[model samples]
Structure formats: C-alpha cells, structure tokens
Target: MRKGKLYLIPTVIAEETQAVVIPPHILQALPGIQYFLAEDIRTARRYLSSLKVYESIEPLIFEVLNKNTKADQLKKFFEPVFQGNDLGILSESGCPGVADPGSLAVKFAHEHDIQVVPLVGPSSILLALMASGMNGQRFAFHGYLPIDGKDASAIVKTLEKESRSKNQTQIFIETPYRNNTLMAVLMKSLADDTQLCIAVDVTGKDESIRSYSVKKWKSIPVTFPKSPAIFLFLSH
Candidate 1:
C-alpha cells in the first residue's frame, strides 16, 4: 500500500487575517484533510472555521502536539497517515517546524520515509526580516533569548559583537508581556551606532516595522504594546 503524505500547513500569524495572509491553495487543500496534528486544537479548529473549506468541522480529527508533547507519543500521530490518510501538521502560529514543536512530527515522517509537503503562509520572522532593512543574505534567528536579566544582557552584547564583526543580522523574539523589558535591555546593551529593528504586530492592521540606532532609540520614549514582535539588529 502507498503511504500518505504529511502536509506541513502554514497558518496566519495574527488572528482575523486569514484572507490576507493564507494562500488560496492552502485553503483549497483543507477540505480533503481529515486528520491533523496541531499545537492547539481549539486554535486549529478556529482557523479551519475561518477557511470555511468544509460545511462542518465535526468530521475533522485533531491531536495535540505542543511543547508538552513527548517523543513516545509522536509516532502515534502518524498512524493515520501510514494507513493511507494524509495528515496535516498545524502550528499555533505561522509555518510548522519553524521555531514550532511541529518539527518533531516532520522529523519523524522523514525517518520513516513519509512524503512531506509544505504550504506557504505568513511567517513573522521572515516578514520582519524582509522589512528590517538589515542583512537578509546572512541572518540568524535565535528563537527566544534568555529571560534572566544578566544572561539576556550578556547574550545581547555577544550577538551585537558577532553582528559587527560578521556583518550579520541577529533576530530574536520575547514573550509579549516581557517585550518592553527586552527592548529596554537591548537599547542599553547595544552600542549607540548599532542598528535595531523592531517589527511589531506583523501582518495585522496595527503592524509597525522600524529600524533605528540604539542611541536614537534611547532618545525616543517608545513602548512596545503587549503583542507579538520580532527584533533584529546589525552592529555594522
């Protein structure tokens, strides 16, 4: 029997922007997918509803695969796919396997030779990078920096130094609630001439993307609203 393909479906980063961010091809493929491995079942269901691909969501099967999902349980999520039913892997936000736990399932699929397909959609990291006016050819995305004050500050300085020497862009994110604190640390830790780009609420109606020197940032009284954001910087 032929094995079913594992689709890495990308979803909108922000809420209420499906029509703007998700491609038509992804929506058109939804009606045929009955089994899904999602980071959050409720969020996944809501996204499917937004697509309106099916008359009803009752027949859809969703299995959780968040940070808490264990290695032992990963194999089970692919059983339906092995039985000749294609499975969709949905992340809580953006594309699956990009800083999301959905990578675990994709890695498993590869080990077992299951065909994998990735559908394009909004990715805050890429969107932010594109708008940052920084080094796009050579950039590194450090998912999230350390939460501890001293540690975070130290890492920020190290990244800045690396950026200066290599002409590379460093990108990172923080929890929404801790965004301001991270911003403050970044402004204080980086050199005056180092360029900083803060991309906030990407793809949302209130989207904002700006780049400035650390000195300029310190001169301005900026506040980061409690929302998803991506921060990038280049020391050169």
Candidate 2:
C-alpha cells in the first residue's frame, strides 16, 4: 500500500499575518506527514514557528521552494515521496495551485500515478467569486499578470474580452506594491460600465470585497496599503 497521500494544503490565510492563524493542532498533525513542499523557506519557517511545532517536529521533513521552481527542483522534491512518502504542498498565502506552487507536483503525480488528495481550507479566488455577484457558473482564474507593464495590459485586455463574451469572471492577482498601478491600468483599459470586484486581504482582519462599475470605482480611493489582493472583472 502507498505510505502516504498528497495533500494540497491551503495556506489560505497563512500568508496574511492579519488573517486566520494556522492552528498548532494542524501543524502538529502535519509532523506525521511524509514531507512538506512550501512556496518559500522563510515563510514556511515562519508558519512552523508560529505554530510552535518547529522544534518538536521529527517525522515531518519539508522542502521549500516557490512557484517559479523548475522541473529539476520538482523531480528532487518528490523523490522521497515517490519512494513511499506522503507529501504536503503549502502556499505562502491562500491555497496551493489556487495561486501557489503545487500544480507541477500535481501534474507530476498524475503522470507518475501518485494518489492526490486535497485538504480543505481558504481559497481567495473562490471567496472573491462567490462574493462578486457575477456569473459564477463559468468563471476563470487568470492567476497573476506579468510584471512587464505591456504584457500585463495585454493579458488584462484579453481577459476582459473573454469575460464580456462568455459572461465569465476574469480573476487576476497582482503584487501588493504595484496593485494601485495595475488597478489604474485596468480601469483605463476596461469600459466605463465594466463591473469590477476588489477582494483584498481576504480571510484577514482587513478583508474587503466591493464591486462597482469601472467609472464609479475609479472615483473612490482604492488604497488598501500593501496587502494581499485578488482583482476580478465580470462582463455584462
């Protein structure tokens, strides 16, 4: 029998210091896990430390890497798991793959015939969509846009068009620091009547969700500081 299962652990609110605190009970249970794949070593350590399970853990060995981790890194990451170890994939924020590093591992597992199990928790994308009052029946999450201003704008426009045509909810994320610039560009590119939803600091103390027409939205100050956010645009 396989010794372990692959768990897509949701960082959900783990990355937001102001959001739900990852419980020690969960971390303690994780020690029994075969391995852990985290987005960032520093943030993973912080989570362990926060749970006070850092030093007490003996069985739970973890490997730290980010979304940009390559095929080589992925192969090495699952070597032990493939050899009969259960692994847990964690994100810096919300959930793994929702916008984190774990898809490659999942794809690799499927290709290698490894059993995959997803652990339930927070997902900003879903949360935002549910609250957006838009067409949730057929929605698309575009993850994060490119850092290059032009590339990002192109993707946004394409997503906007898709949303308009399919009545889809085009969800995209941006770096916190550059969020304002992205939002500004977003409003500029989209039509004045386009509906937009701003979900920032989800599942956190400062969590907020508000939707408005593009023209109306731009009139208000959308300064949410440097916080984790997901931006959604829905078509009429």
Clashing pairs in 2: 12-94
In candidate 2, stretches whose alpha carbon ends up further than 4 angstroms from where it belongs are: 14-29, 52-55, 73-75, 148-151
TM-score, candidate number 2: 0.84
After TM-score superposition, what is the CA distance of residue 200 in candidate 1 from its true location, in Å? 0.4
Model 2: weakest 10-residue lDDT segment is 14-23
Query: lDDT tens string, model 2, 117-194?
Result: 776667878888889888889988876788887888788788888888888888888788988888878877888888
lDDT of each: 0.92, 0.76
- What are the models' TM-scores? 0.98, 0.84
RMSD to the native, candidate 1? 0.9
lDDT of 1 by residue, 1-236 (tens): 78889999998888789888889999888788899999889989988988898999988999999899898997788889888999999988899999899989988999999999999888999999999999999999998999898899999999999999999999998899999999989977999999999999999988989999989999989898999999999998
RMSD in order of candidates: 0.9, 2.9
Q: How many residue pairs clash in each candidate?
A: 0, 1
Per-residue lDDT, model 1, residue 152, is 95
